[model samples]
Target: RKQLVYSSCRAESAGKALADVMPDETVHNILLTASLCMGFSAFSYEFMPTGDARRFNYIAMAMTGFCTIGYVSMYNGVGVIEVRGHDVFWMRYLDWAVSTETFLLGLAMLSGADRWDTIFILAMDAIGVLCALVGALIPAVVAPAYLLGAVVFAAYNYRLFGTMQVSADRMGAAVSAKYKRLTTQSMAAWCVYPVVYLFCEMTRALDETTEVALYACCDVIAKCVCCFLLLSQP
Candidate 1:
């Protein structure tokens, strides 16, 4: 259903064009990542009132907490390796920063998420469409910066799933493999924002938001309808 909307709206075509032009698979990954991430986000906001920045933040923190626990447990089982005192402090600081950032982003989204603006919302939707188009049309050289931006900005998602492991206590090997797959997939999701942002910037670079806007409007209607249903629900 999501892919249908993406395709019917012509985003897939754009992506194909971008993919054709760029030889790198990273471009395609970034393109798909952006579409999936932003599409999920737009869908959630549109259809599920409970889905918002707050939910995103909560999920982020939960993942991070689990990863931290997993890391600690694994270290204990392995017998602690001694680190210089300064290194310990640095690692502790990094952990603190990751946890705090997760909490804060959630808090920020929850406490003061702006009223859903149609233009901005549509603009967000446009991001994926543009990425698809650019990736297909432009040189691969354009991908790295967007990749970097995604890494810098959405880096928190990485820590959230970083330390997850399959435990022998309960799940079978199949379950463990599935969990590992999920963790890796989650890590991939962390890059979606950079792809979307980069794609939008690329289109904006070409002064082509006008065409992108058309594709974006299809998503806009879907989102607005979702928002309406959410409002109508008791």
Candidate 2:
């Protein structure tokens, strides 16, 4: 009887924790609004001409589509999971895993990077994102996982600045200029993600609502605004 009562109490405590951490109605409304914008962005790509640029348009569409789905899931309380008394939005990581790859694909395509270089960059990106997800889910290994993610991100930057830049430069001054601008914008947006994760997940410096809002801003810039910039280039 004592053991049963203890288990029941723990379960109740967990239930309460989940309830407390879940985004309030305001946050849900924000997510819904973001989802609608992303959905519209994804739909707009359908009219893009089918030619050499079609792949880029499709990649942009996929990135926004994934984000739309992720935001909708979060709004519905579908992908929020409790981890060590905190709520982890696993769908955000899922969104990053696929959407960020599409983002990188656009970069690689724009830079005219060789097959091997493209593969290397994409693989490193995946590793970094996976490390971040693992760190968010498991409290004990948070530091090590974050460090690993950072290291992989550094390798990704090396390729972006060195190999990919070289490829873009060979294309011409115009392409190189465009690639540099877009890459700079992408790096600026991406650098915030780990910092936000560290504060919101590791140190608990920011509350859940702030974390979600910050991430939403980053997502809009990285996926939607960046895609529009890329597609606008001649």
Highest lDDT scorer:
2
Backbone clash numbers for all candidates listed: 6, 0
**TM-score of candidate 2 on Cα atoms, chains taken together:** 0.88
Most accurate candidate by TM-score: 2
Clashing pairs in 2: none
Q: Give the whole-model CA lDDT for all candidates, comma-separated.
A: 0.35, 0.88
Q: Model 1, 134: alpha-carbon shift in Å?
A: 23
TM-score for each model: 0.24, 0.88
Off by over 4 Å in 1: 1-154, 166-172, 189-192, 206-234
Candidate 1 whole-model C-alpha lDDT, 0 to 1: 0.35
RMSD values for the candidates in order, in angstroms, are 21.9, 4.4
